[model samples]
Target: MTEVPLIAPLWTVQDVSEYLRVPVQTLYSWRSSGTGPPARRVGKYLRYRPDDVLRWLESLDDGAA
Candidate 1:
């Protein structure tokens, strides 16, 4: 049997903010400073990939500390 991989869905700024529990303004600030997960502008809206966001969150985890 072969395993199937799930595809990550793209999220909006508002969605990402809510999921990350951060203010929308903070996400904008991070985007300006290039410190946030990768995002791309689709038309006039900003979109983020779930995979990238999860990876970024994982990077912030501090299990060793």
Candidate 2:
């Protein structure tokens, strides 16, 4: 039998901050500098895809090598 896959949940700024253990202000600064994970606008707020964040983090590891 085949099973259905589940969708990943979108993350909020606060959720990202907690996940990464970085301060919320730093995220804002990164956004201004275009150095943070890619996010999309939902109305007036920003939303992040977990996959994008994970890929971004992986890219950082790649740069360090």
Candidate 3:
């Protein structure tokens, strides 16, 4: 789905996990450990920027780095 917001696109944890094919728990772990993309808090919920997610993904090597 296309991002609707005008600002940096916000993504749900599930979205990022699914896009990256990683388990949701991994995302939670990264978030709790502050090792992942910066997340925004809104009414106690966490949201990640789509662009940041993409950038973080590009940083992954998968044995290619």
Clashes of each: 0, 0, 0
lDDT of 2 by residue, 1-65 (tens): 99989999899999999998999999999999999999899999999999999888887855544
lDDT of each: 0.91, 0.92, 0.82
Model 1, 1-65: lDDT tens digits are 99999776789999999999999999999999999888999999999998899998888857785
- List of clashing residue pairs for candidate 1: none
Q: What TM-score against the true fold does each predicted structure earn?
A: 0.78, 0.82, 0.72
Supply candidate 1's per-residue lDDT for 60: 80
Task: Report lDDT (Cα) of residue 26, candidate 2.
Answer: 91
Query: The CA-based lDDT of model 2 is what?
Result: 0.92
Best by TM-score: 2
Given candidate 1, what's the lDDT at residue 7?
77
Ranking by TM-score: 2, 1, 3
Deviation of model 1 at 5, angstroms = 9.1
lDDT score at residue 18, model 3, on the 0-100 scale:
86
